[model samples]
Target: MSTSPVHLWGPVRRAENDGVRLAFDALTEGAGGEPLLLVTGLGANRYWVPDGLCLALAQQGFAVARYDQRDSGESTRLPPVATGNPISALFGRRGAAYTAEDMADDAAAVLDALGWGSAHLLGVSLGGAIAQRVALRHPDRVRTLTTMAAVPADVSGLATLRYIRVGTLAKFARLRFPDTADGAVAAGIAVSRLLASPSRPFDENAARADALRNLDNGLHDRQAQSRQIGAQWSGPRIDAITRPSLVLHGQDDPLIKPTAARAIAARIPGARLRLLPEVGHELPARAWDTIADELRTLAA
Candidate 1:
């Protein structure tokens, strides 16, 4: 089934930390309710988060905000650095641009700009790893922590391979689209389809719509992806995350294995885990209510 088109909560706002500028927006001001910050997956823009999901969370009394990570979307793109083969960089020792710590601080910068001292963290995939680091680095800035389809923060190198689907990575490498605007949209839909569950009849409608709105095509930049994936975390382990946490995974996810979510839940004390059947790497419309309900409960 197709989902609704993306809805912009407000005009894009800027948040600066160190030298990097972040682009963010909120559906709610978060005055009388909990402020929720959404962190999307690797190379994904804030628009990647569906409007229906945000509305669902708003219905549950959450003031939700989503932002573009560094080098993605309207955010500042760092100077080009030679980060050879994104996969090689994934298991490398050093980042070509910045540290993962810097990325975590970006989230806090967005919170500061919004005038919210702290907010609940909801992250997906690479976003989930950032959320975990944010909680560890800035505990006071996080009320609750939730990670979806993410690997553990501390696990890297050969150990990380255990939780990944190598074939999926290969498929990502094979994706080809022109540099044109229409190409960006096509690339976006192609990537979404690859992440989607094989059991479900893939619908390009929602993906195509989001692609049209978020035409930046961050995914096509392999070096930028490398910098993001290569950034190492030297901070506290996930076990140190004391905030109330929830780990959600799709049982049928083809990109990241279910074990990745389990590993995260196991690392964080008292973190709850949920494996959704018939789901995939992409958050389908059918799972929006359940995700909202879980977030509401976690915030309470």
Candidate 2:
């Protein structure tokens, strides 16, 4: 099924943090209702939320806002990798460093700039790691939390395996390719092929289109990806979070194993976990209805 084109309404006044000015798109059904803030994963722009999912949430009476993180999309870019290695930085060795807490702070700053006291927060993959930190660090700013395909503090089992594979691949890519146009194209092709696998349940045309759009948008800044990767490797402790939470995962996710979701749910007190059998790492456009229904339930 095809989704209606997304209608974005903003170059809204986003707060500046850490030498970066945030940019966000806000969709509201009305003035008085629960607001939902979406955070994207590593190497992703706001569009990664998917038009269908955003529209679904809007239809469910939520005022949703999705933004480009500091180094992705139209947001600011950090200096090129010079002395510090991006891969080493991820493992907390020796490099330019920023924690998921810092990212969470950025989110809070966005909320402040928008005059929102509190809102439901939803994040996917690395974004989920940031959301957990946000809810833990700024408990008052988050009403409800949903973490999709993320891991908690201690990395073990399949989550560790996935991280090792992704980190190693990313490191190799950065050292060898280093953001060249050709590298971007190659990466896009690889991603497209991976997502087109039968277990992924995605539209190949749309996947390719999104991949090329991302490349065209220059969304693969190495420094930003490095910082984000660092945050994910050493994520925050979620045990302190008291907010009602939902953890969603695809049983067939190749990148982040389903057990990671179980671990995340285990850490957050009383957090609910839902596992879908066929979905993979990428959130399919067809799952918009399921995502919307889940978010609505969380908001309620």
Candidate 3:
């Protein structure tokens, strides 16, 4: 298989609600008819949408668009950490301060900027949370929904070792080495380790290379990561999503547990859930084919 990275680029587009501009990459041209919008997870840029996955989806006749969430990739960042702690904003007693609803609005604004009235939506992890909110709040903008390794609010015990390790390491690394390139390298290594699975080992070297490439590409904007994390909405509100949906989760996922996926599937009316035993929190290269197949099936 060719490992050449898919080239994607876009100029910033200002969101209508706020002046926040979102950076996105679009893979168009070969798509037969349906357009797919991919929302990435926290701390990750559009590159997290694996190249193989994108090519597979493209081959299946879907124009795939993946973008950095606000505060992460090429997107806008929130106010400085001194003004407010983004993490605290999400978990405080104010009941999910920013909320996934706002994120859904942001996704809608992206589609509007693209001149697409509606499209298929796919989100991973935290991105899935935002996508769910989008589907619930703006059903008219979504043709179908596919959430992978995502959970709803009120769903506790959703963290995996990968999540814990990455979160802990990133926090500590930032505090100790804030202004150094080593900090970024260390953080990338931690994420790479966390994403690797024993049963389905990923190419750590490749992951590291990609991590560095992503960082060099100006895609690793830390402030944006904090903002996206701060904007999360937790609880059982996923029941309101009435669109045709598919939830994919790895049985061995260390971050959001499989049960979280089950809960999300249960709440969504007529949603389909698929559990893969060999996969993990990170989508391994080996499993791209299976995931792509499922997504194509759902899109069809």
Location of the lowest summed lDDT over 10 successive residues in candidate 1? 1-10
Write one digit per residue (lDDT tens) for candidate 3, span 1-300.
Answer: 123534433444454547767777676445455778988877676766777777777777778777767666667755655314334433341223345557778898888877789999989888787888888788899999999877774332333232333454344334422334655655555565664554676676776676665552222444444455555454336787778999998877665567778878888999999997777777777778887888888877
Q: Which runs in model 3 stand beyond 4 Å of their true positions?
A: 1-16, 29-32, 81-90, 93-97, 153-182, 216-224, 232-236
Put down candidate 1 lDDT per residue, 134-213, tens digits, no spaces.
99999999999999999998887778889999999889878777778988889888988999988888878867877887
Following a full C-alpha superposition, what root-mean-square deviation does model 3 have from the true structure? 4.1
What are the lDDT scores of the predictions, listed in order? 0.86, 0.69, 0.67
Q: Could you give the candidate ranking by lDDT, starting with the highest?
A: 1, 2, 3
Best by lDDT: 1
Candidate with top TM-score is: 1
What clash pairs does model 2 have?
none
Off-target runs (Cα >4 Å) in candidate 2 are 1-8, 28-32, 81-87, 153-186, 195-197, 200-202, 212-219, 232-236
Candidate 1 lDDT score relative to the true structure: 0.86
Model 3 weakest 10-residue run by lDDT: 154-163
Total clashes for model 2: 0
